[model samples]
Structure formats: C-alpha cells, structure tokens
Target: MARVAGKVALITGGASGLGLATAKLMAAEGARIVITDIQKNKGPGAAKEIGGDTLFLEHDVTSEERWQQVVVETEKKFGKLNIVVNSAGIGTEGTIEDTSLADFRKMMAINVEGTFLGCKYGIEAMKKHSEPSSIVNISSVAGLVSGFQMCAYSASKGAVRLLSKSVALHCARAGYNIRCNSVHPAFISTPMVEAPLAAASDPEKARKRLLRMVPIGKIGEPNDIGYMILYLASEESKFVTGAEMVVDGGCTAM
Candidate 1:
C-alpha cells in the first residue's frame, strides 16, 4: 500500500520550494492534498501538475481568519484532516543591530505567528477526524544554532521550534491523538535562497560560501526535505512528537 494512503494533507506555502515538493510526494503516496499559498498564480499550476488528488487555495499564513477558512474548506472537501505541513516561511538577512522593528515583526508574523496559527487550527481541524493525525512545522537550522546576520530569521524560527514542542506536549497532556514536530533544514536550494544569492555582488562566490557551511559539501534539494516531511506526515513517525528533525546535510554536526 502507498505510505500515506487515504490520508488528507494540507500544506501551506505549497506553491513552490519545499512545500511544493512535499505536496507532490504526499499526493503520490495516495494522500489527498490541499495546498495553500499567497502565490495564487503559481498555485493553480502546481495543483494541475500534481493531478487529481490535489487542490490549491490562495492563502496568506499570517491571517487567522484565512487559516480558519482553509481549515473549513479542507474538511468540507476531504471529509477528514490527517496531516498539516506548515512550510510557509521567509528568511531575512540582518544582524540584530541592523534589523529594524518592522523587518523583525514581518518575519515574526510570517514565520513564527504563521506556524503557531497552523498548529492551533490544524489540531482543531484534525480532531474531527476519526483517526490520529500529525502536524509538521518547517523550521530551519537557524532555529537550532546562531549565525552572523541572521538574528530576526533565527529568532522567528526559534519561536517556531519551541512552539512546536509546546503544542506537542499540550496535545499529549490533553490526551489528544495528535502529534506535532518541527523540521530544521539548512540551505536547501530553492527560489527563496536563489533570489538572495543572485543579488550578491559575487553570486557564484556567495553560493560557494553558503555551501561550505554544510559539512556534506552540497546544498539540499527541495525533495530532500520533502521526503522527511512525508515520513513525519505518515504513520511511520507515530512515536515521534515534540522532536526537531534536522535536514541540513550535517551542517549542525560541526
């Protein structure tokens, strides 16, 4: 049988990058997928590429009302909610001193608050299902370690990491059959990273510099993280909750 057969998955930021890859992987494993992202133009295309089992919704993760709408629409369409992958996030480049309050708040709104809302609404939605469910929040290596020029981004991700654990423990204590976890990846090759790299004075040099941070000597592909997401979204990770899984090519090992 397919790994996630009969599961219904909702993935935020599913229009591109890791979320897009995860959506494809989940759908292939026989799960019905509901992908939401603010990139409305690309969303329909991604849904079409994923074929019949997938649906796309225009979503902005920072909005609570929008999250509620996504939850209601997903349940209405799929009849049950089994998995939620909160892969919607953004990264900013700045040190604490250089970062502005506006910039920091933007990061928090999208990355931290976005994740918290996903977990809040996801747990509520999944409870309506007859079976247990899982929630996967996409964090980053920044959440686990400190680095130069990454204050706001790191702070936001750190909040996501701990929030995931908090929610996981809450679910466990409440005797709810829902599991929550976070995935922390480093330098996965995606448009999100590419844009910044291309803007550098020495783009190739910048890419190489970023690569050197990973002990594995290579950047990760979207699918690399996607596959990890699939495992957590599946029954295979039933015992795994309140844990942080790193997909950073051993970057944090050093």
Candidate 2:
C-alpha cells in the first residue's frame, strides 16, 4: 500500500523548491494534496503537474487570518487534515552588521511567524478529526549551527527548530494525537540554493564552495528531504515527535 494512502497533506511553498518536491512525493504515495504558495502563477501549475487528488491555494503564511483560512479550506476540500508542512521560508545572506533590523524582522515574519501560525492552526484542524497527524517544519542546517553570512536566516530557522518541539509537546500532552517536528536540510539543489549561486560573480566557484561544506561531496536532492518528510507524514513515524530530523548529507556531522 502507498505510505501516505488516504492521507491529506497541506504543503506551503509548494509552487517550487523542496515544498513542490514533497508535494509530488506525497501525492504519489496516495495523499490528497493541498499546495499553497505566495507565488500565484506557479502554484496551480504545480498542483496540476502532481495530477491527483490535489489543490492549489494562494497563501501568505505570515498572516494569521490567512493561516486560519488555509486550514479551513484544507479540511473542507479534503474532509480532514492529517499533515501540515511549513515549507515556505526565505534565506538572506548577511553578517550581523550587514543585516539591518528591517531585514531581520522580515525574515522572522515569514520564517518564524509563518511557521508558528501553521502549527497553531494545524493543531486546530487536526484536532477536529481523530487521526494521528504530523506537522513538518522545513528548517535549515543554519538553524543548528550559525554561518557568519546567514545571521538573520539562522535566527529565523533556529526559532523554528525549538518552536516545533514546543508545539509537539503541547499537542502530545493534550492528547491531540498530533506530532510536530522539523526537517533540516543543507545545500539542497533547489531554487533557494540556486538563487545564491546564480548571483555569484563566479557561479561555478560558489557551487564548489557549497560542495566543499558537504562531507558527502555532492549537493542534496529535493527527494532526499522529501522522503524523510514522507516517513514523518506517514504512520511509520507514529512514535516520532518533537524531533529534529536532519537531512543534510552529513553537513552537520563535520
């Protein structure tokens, strides 16, 4: 049987990158997928490409009202909510001095605030049903260890790392049957990584720099994290909650 058979998954940032990758994988595993993104143009096409029990919604994750609406829509369309993946985030490159207060706040708004709202509303939606559910927040390896140029991004993701654990504990103690965890990936071959590389004066050199950080000697694929998400969203990870699942190709091992 499909791993997530009959499950309903709502993935943010699903228009592209790791979110799109996870949406595809879950759909293939028999999940009814709700793909949400701030990019209005790409989201519908992605849902169509997934080509199953899938939906696309225009979402701005930073809005509390929007988060509530998305959760309601997911439950209405799919009849229940079993999985919530907060895959939408932004990465800004700057040192502590280079990152302005506005930039730091913006990063926190989308990355931390967006994820907090997802967990808040996801818990509400999942509690409406009796099934065991999972919430996967896409964090970065920067969350575990700081990079000099990633001050704001690191701060945002570090918040997500602990926020997920808090949410997991809250739900578990309340007997909501909802599990919350975070997935940390390093240098995945997604648009997020590609954007920085594309902007470099020497794109190849920048690429090599990234490769040097990975002990595995290659950039990670989207499916690398996607499969870990699959396991978490499925019944297989029933015992797992409040955990930080790192899919970094040993980037943090060093």
Candidate 3:
C-alpha cells in the first residue's frame, strides 16, 4: 500500500517550498490533500499540480476563525482529519537591540500563534477519527540553536518546538490516539533562503557564506524536509510523538 493510503492531510503554507513539496509527496503516496496558504495565486496551482483528490484554500494561519473554518471545511470535504502540517511561518533578520516590537510580533503571530491554532483545532477535529492522526509543525534549527542575528525568527521557531511537545504530551495523556511532532531544518535551498541571498549585493558570495555553515558541503532540497514530514504524517512514524526531528545538514551538530 502507499504509505499514507486513505489518509487526509491539511498542509498550511502549501503554496510553495517545503510545504508544497510535502503536499505533493504525501498526495502521491495516496493521501487526500487539502492545501492552504495566504498566497492565493500559487495555492490553487500547487493543488492542481497534484491533480487528484487535492484541494486548495486561501487561509491566514494567524486567524483563529480561519483555522476553525479550515478544519471544518476539510472535514466536510474529506470526511476525516488524519494529518496536519503546520508549515506557515515568516522570517526576519534583526538583533534584540534593534528588532522592533512590530517585527517581533509579526514573526510571533505567523510562526507561534499559527502553529498553536493548528494544533488546537486540528486536535479537535482529528480526535474524532478512529485511526491515528499526526500533526507536523515545521520549526527550525534556529529554534535549537541561538541565531542572534535572526532574533524574532529564532524565538518564534523555538516557541513552535516546545509547543509541539506540549501538544503531543497532552494528546497522548488524554488517550486521543494522535501524534504531534516538530521538524527543524536549516538552509534548505528554498525561496525562504534564496530571496535573502538574491537580495544581497553579492548573491554568489552570500550563497557561499551560507554554505560554509553546513559541514555536509551541500545545501538541502525542499524534499529533504518533505520526506521527513511524510514519515511523520504516515503510520510508519506511529511510534513517534513529541519528537524534534532535525533536518539540518549537521549545522546544529556543530
């Protein structure tokens, strides 16, 4: 059987990059997919690319009302909620001394509050299912390590990591038959990393500088994280919960 056969997954930030990659992969592996993103232009295209039993919705993960509606719409359409990938997040480069409260709050709203809402409503919907369900939150190596230059981004991801664990423990203790985990990745060669490099005065120099942080001698691909998310979303990872799966290329190891 396909790894996620008969499963239903709702992936946030599914318009591009890691979230899109995860949606495509999971759908290919025989899951019904509902992809949501604030990027209206790309979300439908992402869902269409999968071309089978897939849907796209415009969503703002920071909105609690939208989260509730999304869960409702997904269940109404698919009949059950089996997997959730909380991949919506924003990044900012600043230090504690200079980072504005506005910037910090924006990061927190999307990264922290967004994942919190996903877990909250996703649980409410998923617990009704008889099969095991999974919630995968995309965190970052910055959460495990201190990235002083990315103050708001790092703090937001750190909150996601711990919040995932807390949700996992809560569901497990309550006998909800659900799994929750966080994924931490760094320099995954997506738009998230490329946009900043392309904006730099010397993109090549910026790329090289970023590569030096990884001892693996290569940057990562979107599917690198996508595959990890696939495992967490499938029953293959049934034994896994409250886990922090790191996909960085030995960056945090150093």
Deviation in Å, model 1, residue 32 alpha carbon: 0.3
Q: RMSD, model 2, all Cα superposed? A: 0.8
Q: After superposition, how far is residue 184 of candidate 1 from its true place, in Å?
A: 0.5
Candidate 2, lDDT over the whole model:
0.93
Tens-digit lDDT string for candidate 1 (39-113)? 999999999987776889999999999999999999889888889999998887899899999999999999999
Better of 1 and 2 by TM-score: 2
Among all windows of ten consecutive residues in candidate 3, which has the lowest summed lDDT?
Answer: 44-53
The better candidate by lDDT, 1 or 3, is 3
In model 3, which runs have C-alpha deviations exceeding 4 angstroms?
none
Write candidate 3's Cα lDDT for 40-126 as tens digits: 998878889977969999999999999999999999999999999999888879999999999999999999999999999999998
Whole-model lDDT values for every prediction: 0.93, 0.93, 0.94
Q: Kindly list the per-residue Cα lDDT of model 2 for residues 2-32, writing each as its tens digit.
A: 9999889999999999999999999999999
lDDT, residue 249, model 2: 87
